[model samples]
Target: MANTTALLFFSLAAFAACSPSTCTFIPSTNATTTNYPGSSFIKTSAYPYNISVLSEVPIATICTSPTGNRTAELACARIYIDAIDEQLAFLYARRLGYAAVAGASKFATNTSLNDPSRNDVVAAGMAAKVLKYGATEAAGAVMGGEGCMIYAALKYEVETIQEECNNKFTVDVERVCK
Candidate 1:
């Protein structure tokens, strides 16, 4: 149990340190209207990513308490951060000009990764893992001790989402589509 926890903690830290840029959210103006100010309209042509599915992991596994019960608190903090991050990313993306469509319907058929919620869900799961493994093992405690990892993950994810949106907007919509 101790070894497993330690491994999880180290892995989360390594991921955070090495993959910081993967999830930063940059502002994009490719999809926006007066209906909202901080919202942008994302068009099909505005999507900059080459869309990949990556790996699949269950949210329950991450959010639920393991043998140590540290994950419950981590899940709470993660959910809070997820709400803030998702809202911010959507608002920022909309503000930058990306419009929100329900999914990959005709309206968003051309959009890359039509579901913003997908990212949030994944982030929430990641937060759970970080809390489960990193917070508990590193601190030998739960809840209060896990706060730092949550904050770190939150900061990293938000920044990555924003960066991705901004970079896409700049390249596809502002530069090419304009």
Candidate 2:
């Protein structure tokens, strides 16, 4: 448990500490673990925020990483920053991001494969959590083919911050991502 916290601090600190020169080329052997935050992040803003929880950034923020290292993590800081100013705004951004991406996906667009199957219903039907995961995987495949550190971190940040938004008020998939 202590080890995990230290690692988190190290990774984030390394990222914070990284400078243009210090953050050089990461080799191909960087970590590929993809255990990012799931979709239940709406809990962060659900409960009360008092001194009792002041020391924490919401336990929901502690995502489950499969197995990662500092190499990719630190590099992520250079590319993406996820410190949204407002919680509801965070959720809105996520919903919009997912909708925009899903709408433009090859399966959703007729311009890509020349196919007529615009399966946007899939996106609309997905639960809030499913939307987050699918978008990360889809974005990662398109953006992280090289397994670059920046892209990996982008995926992680995207998932992590999206977990910190307001829940849909209920898990009814119908009204969740809608």
Candidate 3:
């Protein structure tokens, strides 16, 4: 009876520890609530970006890896940066495409992009560091082809800010591009 109880306890503990459903990425409280002058753009665009990235980069795979903690940290940073990129896209669209005077005024006044203390900026810095680590790791080992290539490209895109999260919040390119 004692041995059976111990076995059950260990089994339950292992299940709790390994459950993928328990793992989730939550944004920083400040990032979630930040209300910049033109924050509506960010609020609208962030969800799809989060969903797209989350789908492309399987949380279970990253969360279960030996370096799971680092990978999960990078994932969170990627989500936050994607949100911020939405704001930047809105600013650019408003300025160059729509010629909105209000957007220009907001862009001139909004200092969040340059402020190192802002949640988005802090998250970007963290993402950059982790991506460098991931790229190094990728280069050192065999990544098993397409999945590994996708991860590498994601790190590159995050590092370069080449793929901005626009109004579309599309990750189609990230999914298919090699």
Tell me, by TM-score, which candidate is best. 3
* Model 2 CA RMSD to the hidden true structure, in angstroms: 23.7
| Per-residue alpha-carbon lDDT of candidate 1 for residues 30-118, written as tens digits (9 for 90 to 100) | 43353232224332221112211112212334455556677575865565454444444544455323222221121223344323344
Backbone clash pairs for candidate 2 read 41-163
Model 1: how far residue 45 lies from native, Å: 28
- The C-alpha lDDT values of all candidates are 0.38, 0.33, 0.38
| TM-scores of all predicted structures | 0.19, 0.18, 0.21
lDDT of 3 by residue, 94-175 (tens): 3332222222222234322222133234344544555665654333222322233333333333322212211222223222
Model 3 CA deviation exceeding 4 Å by range: 1-68, 97-178
Q: TM-score of the candidate numbered 1?
A: 0.19
Alpha carbon deviation, residue 132, candidate 3 (Å) = 25
Worst 10-residue lDDT window for candidate 1 reads 169-178
Q: Per-residue lDDT of 42-86 in model 2, one digit per residue for the tens?
A: 334333233122253344323323466555555543222232223
RMSD score of candidate 1 (Å): 24.2
